[model samples]
Target: MANVKFDHITVRYGSHTVLQDFSLDVESGKIVCLVGPSGCGKTTLVRALLGLNKPETGVITVGERCLFDAKKHVNVPAEKRNIGIVFQDYAVWPHMTVLENVSYPLKKQRRPKEEIRERVMHALEQVHMTEYARHLPNQLSGGQQQRVAIARALVVDSDVLVMDEPITNLDAKLREEMLLEIRMIQKRLNATILYITHDQQSALQLCDKMAIMQQDGTLCQYGTDEEIILHPANRFTFEFIGVSNFIPLRQAGSGLALDCGELIPYTGEVPPQAENGGFDLGVRPNDIVFDPASPLKARVDSRVFLGSEYNYFLSLGQKQIRVQQSMLDARTRGVAKEGETVGISFLNTRFYPTQKGEQTP
Candidate 1:
């Protein structure tokens, strides 16, 4: 396994610069997910590292090899880079059996038949797909097909494996199973993986560290899920990582008030920076609790029971915010009807400094 480096990388198309001065270091033998929205240059970065796209300025290195260096005028071919990529669609051939698919890379290199068989079976075993070696791609489940795609990437024993939205086609249940499967495979091989996706939930479950990118191709924050979620670097990181509710705040006499159509007195402690004015109070859905004795009132617009939790949409004055309650909490406290007016209070909230006159969304 190798540590992948993207040092001061920038990629452009025609006159437009899609990626600008992006730098990230994927530690050796660890899974790092590059998560962001669509058109955020996530795949562009991957392509540049894979030698498929030339970076305008930067250095790309894996292990001891320098695959690309813009100043040195060095550009390795895609095949010689020794980096494996599992695409969004898996890209397995329907006409080929699992063993044939896994062995194709070696066959292209014209490796010894005996060597191909050994490596192919070993890769299949790593993904727990050895039993279905003879099965065609069409005969396998979506998860099983993904395993074949991963096994093919492993046959060459690349230093880094790139999974780009690899399980987006799977159903919710299958997606969870595949995430666990990918984690197990990574552990068994101690593989250096760069998983790219727009899905934060999956990234939270699979990454050793996560790199968040903004829509304008800027790297927002890079850290463990806990670090990013609990201590967000900025408002973008806070809103992007989880379910967030933002309420506009303004100065009301000696204290603060929520600008939710009506001026509701904020009994919560105000952070020092937000004391002067114009800040958005960002709260996670789970942090908002119902309080019968509280003056902060909101009308419940809808209630949904999601097996393990309850999701409620509440309208506060003219603003709407989401609230989630665990099954135990719902049963202990009580559930709210669609038209019921309830008092809600925030627990852990973050203050986001905004432009002085910025209106609420």
Candidate 2:
């Protein structure tokens, strides 16, 4: 296994910069996911690591070997990098049988026929595609073709695996199944994985570490799933990773007052360095509770049935807040009828200073 490192990397096109001074490290044998919105340079990072794009500055290293260094003028070819990559499109050879596709990498090494066949069959079995080994990619379902692609990547025995939105094309159930399969394979192989996706749910479920990027290619935040969820660095990090309700607030005396005619006790001290200006309160949908006894009240604006739970959109004065409750709570407590009034309480509240329409640290 290899630890991948990006040191002060920058990429530019013409005069416009894409990624600027980006640095991150992927620890060996750990799955790290890079997630962000479209045009955020997630793909650009992957391309640079894969030797498809060259950075205008800085260095990239895998383990102790320097892969790219602008100062040293060293550039390693993709084929010599010894890394396995699985694309979102399931880049399988349509004309090749499943077994043949899995064995393609082995053929490049001039391995003996018996050993190659053994490795190919083992890889197919690992991905549960042994039954379809004789079938071509055209004959298999999307999920099966993806499994073949995984098998091909695994059969090479590479130390690091890079997957680029591999499950985006699958149906919900199939996507879940593939996620489990990929996790199992990674565990079994102890492979260091760098997965790139825009889906926060997938990143939460699959990666041990995650980094969020911006449109300008700067990294907004990088940490474990829990850290990113509970302690978002800014508004963009909060909104990008999950659903959050932002309520306007202002400083009043020693405490903060909601702009909407309500005042909740502030448990933490707002930073003294924070500009004496507008602020916003952030709470996730799951962090808001429906309490009938609470003084703060809201009218039910809409409701959505979400299988095991119900999501309610409530109007608190002019502000809208979303609350999630168990299906049983919805049924027993009686669903919040449209225009019906209900009390609201914050389960976990946080305050941030807003500067020029952006949340500041």
Candidate 3:
């Protein structure tokens, strides 16, 4: 496996810049996930890395080899880059059987027939698709077809594997199963993976490191899942990766006063350079603590059963907050009915300046 690097990369279409001065280093034998919203340049960045698109400026390198360098006028073709790509569509030939599909890449290299058959069979067994080796793509289920596609990519023994939302089409159960299988395969092969997906859960589960991008193709934040969750670099990154409850507040004497017209204690110092006007207090749903004896009160607006937990929507006068708890005690957990008053406290909270009347913090 080889390390991949992007240095001051820029990609544009007409006058619109899709990616701007983006740079990232992906270490060898590690899984890195690229995550963002629908219009974000996640896909564009992956395409560029795969050598499908050339950047207008900057350079891309896989180990010591320069894949793209504008000043040097060097551009490596996609097929010559030796990178494997698993697209969301599976990209399997309908008429080809599983074995033939997996062996196609070996055929391109003109390997011996026996060697090709051995590699293809081993790859199929790796993905547990050996039982259906002779089955056509049309005869396999979506999950089986996806396995065949993975086996095809694996058979070539490419060092770098790029998968773009490969499991997005599967059902919840199948998606989980596929994720486990993929993780096992990657561990066994020690392959370098660059995964692109909008699903936060998938990224959190699979990626060793992750980068969050904006619609303009700019890198917002790149870090471990824990770092991004606990210490978000910006307001946008905070809301996108996890659930956040925004409580409007204004600076008071030494603390901050809730827009609910109540004063709440703060444990940390708010920056003096903070913008004027209202500020927002961010609290995760799981961080909200409920106590029957506390003074701060809220009424239960709604509650929903979520299998392992119960989601509660609590209303404090005109403001609404969400809280989640284990599904152990139906009496205590479910006791808070609609309009029932109860005390509330936050386990942790973050502060940020309000933006455009929205509590992005």
Candidate 4:
């Protein structure tokens, strides 16, 4: 397995900067997911890693090999990188059989016929597609075709794997299945992986480390899912990764007081990089408690039952708040009709400043 690193990477299109001073290190055998909204340069980073996009100023290294170095003016071609890439649309040849598609990489490297067949069969078996070796791309289902793409990527035994929205086209159930399957295969092979996706749930579920980037090419945060969920770096980070209720706050003595007239105890300290105070309170939907007797009151605007839980959208004046609760009560879980008044309280919350760096209201 190989580790990947980018040193002060800067990518630009003409005069517009796409990525600025981006640096990251992915340890060997670890899976790192890059997630953010569209136009956040997620695809740009993927292209750069595969040597498809060259950075204006940076050094890219995979294991001991330097793929791109701006100072040395060295650029490695994508074909020679030996890195496996799985695209969102499974790029299998419609005319080729599964075996032929999987063995194409070996053929390109001019491996012996016997070795190519052995490796191709092994790769197909790993993805449970051995039975469909004779099937053509057009004959297989969407999920089956994706499996072929994965087999092709793995057949080369590349140390680094880059997947860009690999499950975007699959159904929800199939996506979940593929997620587990890919994770298991990666662990078994100990391959270093960089997964790029717009789905936050997939990123949170699969990544050992997660990175959230902004539309302006700034990295909002980088950490484990738990760390980012518990303590977000700034307002954008909190809002981008998951659902959050941003309650307005104002300075009250040493602490901050919410617009609902509740006082949050003072912490007496803030991030040194933050230039302001009492910006907003960020609380996840799951962290908020729903009770009929709490001091805070809100009207339920809408509700949706999601099998095992209920998601209630409440309106606190003009602010729309969301709360998700487990369906413990079969009868009462979906009983909250629209416009019903309900009380709410926060269990876990964090304060975020109004401005961080160049971010504004």
Write down the TM-score of every candidate: 0.94, 0.88, 0.90, 0.87
Q: Top lDDT: which candidate number?
A: 1
- C-alpha lDDT of residue 72 in model 3: 95
Best by TM-score: 1
Error of 4 at 359 (Å): 14
- Global lDDT of each model? 0.92, 0.84, 0.83, 0.83
Query: By descending TM-score, how would the candidates be arranged?
Result: 1, 3, 2, 4
Expressed as tens digits, the lDDT of each residue in 145-221 for candidate 2 is 99999988888777688999988998988898888888898888788999999999998899889998877788989
- Tens-place lDDT digits, model 1, residues 20-97: 888999999999999999999999999998888999998989988999999999899998989888997658999999
Residue-by-residue lDDT tens digits, candidate 3, 76-170: 88878888888997578998998889999899989999999999999999999999999998999888888988898888878688899998998
How many steric clashes between backbone atoms does each model show?
Answer: 0, 0, 0, 0
lDDT for model 1 comes to 0.92
Worst 10 residues of 2 by lDDT: 266-275
Alpha-carbon lDDT of model 2: 0.84
- Model 3: ten consecutive residues of lowest lDDT: 268-277
By TM-score, is 2 or 3 better? 3
